[model samples]
Target: MAAEFDTLAEWTAQVATDLGSSFKIPAACRGSGSLAVLDWLIDELHLSHGGSLLDCGAGMGGPAAYAVRQRSVRPLLVEPERGACRAARSLFGHPVVRASALALPVGDDSFDAAWSLGVLCTVPDQLALLTELRRVVRPTGRIGLLVFVARSSEPFPHPDGNHFPTEARLLSLVEKAGLGIEDWRGTEEMAGPTPEWQSRVEKVTAELADRHRGQRAWQLAERQSQLIGQLLADSTVTGELLTLRRR
Candidate 1:
């Protein structure tokens, strides 16, 4: 029997909780797009002060390493997936632990900068994740995030899922989570994607496909590529960073 589902929210809730290697994202897209976002996030966090960084859900260490390399900041990572934690450690030997966003295994108010790079959208309790981040950062410290959103429609719930919060909704989530934002914006306006990005993606896809053999994984990758390519080609994502500061 096909697995039964009650509502889109039900599926979404599951996806938000899941952290699998084969998410609906092309590895190439996740990497390059992350690099682009980090460039801007780094600049913003640097102004406030840049050290003792914590990267929530540091999958593959690409983003952390990128931040360290470009911004000259070392990042401690927390991820729920043992696979991701191991993979990240193999690549950089940075400090990373297997943990969930809801319960961080760290002391409170210890970090100067904390960030969630494409990590917040999944966890069932957005408020819990945000609160943990807030708890770990000093009052004036900063938190950066990159999450998925939709306007009229929310994301379908798979193991690895997304949430599309309205601007007002997002602010509420942040405030309730016990933190306030500093600055936030959409990638399409300053960063996102361009037509020429495909040239880069095409090159990367060819190199990785042979290594990644699962059919479902490959198809999901293709689908996400199309969606992001479209998002890059033209800004279509409903969610945009609504910059905030903790009160």
Candidate 2:
């Protein structure tokens, strides 16, 4: 995945420039697309210096590394994927525990706060994931989540066969999980899909197709990005950030 590495390298450089920090980001841990929103979510957590945070679906550990270095928050990354778990340790020496979000391996009240980036929508059992998040974090711990939700009843195709919950369904799940809503808002006002986002998706799609014509991961990422772009363009899907506190 030369293209993936190249894109990540470029983005990391830009982030370094914008933030004025020379913290090196590993390419293997960088997720696709603009990660500008990551900073906002980190800020939402209001983590104190040297506090611990749980990173649900911690992919590649790039974000975890950045969190530790920049935010000064000790992060425990939990990722189920074997490759990603290894990459996190190998690339950044970030502490990683291999586990599913539905059932975190850590003990109860283990972290000061927790956050998940772009992972909640893909889970088939959102309530279970929410419950687990509540379980692992301490009472009154803040949780920051970024997800894409259905703007209408229209079905959106996803590679993982997961459906986006409506606003009401999400609220119900939050209540069921015993999480108090600290804040909820649409991300469009803060960061909507721009031409640059579309261009980057297209570039990544083409690169994936050229590199691996028949690979499932390549095909899935390409198709998912296309559908998301379409849904975003038509306003059928909305990106959201939710802040919750364990009760």
Candidate 3:
């Protein structure tokens, strides 16, 4: 029988299953940005006990789980991939909804705050995603984002399914979406993973090698990660963290 996998979301789900109780370690390192980045956003969003948060495009429920763990907040995860949704439920026991960011299933003013990490580049309709966020979050609610902005107009190799926006274009989209910028920061270099984070990732990698070293799905996911790393390293893309308020 063929190995049951195709997308990076599947690979991430497998990793989450293998990690089991320690899933949050690698979970903290992936998708949501580093620990430092998460801290900044969580603090700026003012997440506290009993508060509600909506994680847009939450893959495998890593960052959302981390937020719940750190702040005791209630979290709802919105992910498009089925495998990821399943993994997120198993890994963190949080409510996972399989849906697109452009059209969330929840009602208006549903969440206290909303955030998307490393997800803006993947969606072509950036304005639509932001507008959806603005609608779901209450008026004056905060919306945090970690986006990879294009460094130049010159054509550059980017991972498949990505539509990175220039900094000016991203800002314009936020304004059109009815959100006002509250805080902005440029992360010139991605922060290095903490020691625990590195160790946890290595553990997952070792298990993957042991289980499916040469599988096509694994290779494809690895290639995608490498391509993204190269883009960040060569200054082809720059990371931008923004905190916006629903207007």
Candidates 1 and 2 compared: the better one by lDDT is: 2
Reference-based lDDT, each prediction: 0.59, 0.69, 0.80
Candidate 2 residue spans exceeding 4 A from truth: 1-36, 191-216
Find the candidate with the highest lDDT and give its number.
3
> Which 10 successive residues of model 2 have the least lDDT summed?
1-10
Pairs in clash, predicted candidate 3: none
The runs of at least 3 residues in candidate 3 whose Cα sits more than 4 Å from the true structure, single-residue gaps closed, are: 1-11, 188-191
Q: Which has the higher TM-score value, candidate number 1 or candidate number 2? A: 2
List runs of model 1 lying over 4 Å from the truth: 1-34, 47-50, 153-160, 192-201, 220-236, 242-244
Rank ordering of all candidates by lDDT, starting from the highest: 3, 2, 1
Candidate 2 lDDT, 88-161, residue by residue in tens? 66556778888888989989998899988767887889999999999888886889887788877666564354
Instruction: Specify the highest-TM-score model's number.
Output: 3
Consecutive 10-residue window with the lowest summed lDDT within model 3? 1-10
Better of 1 and 3 by lDDT: 3
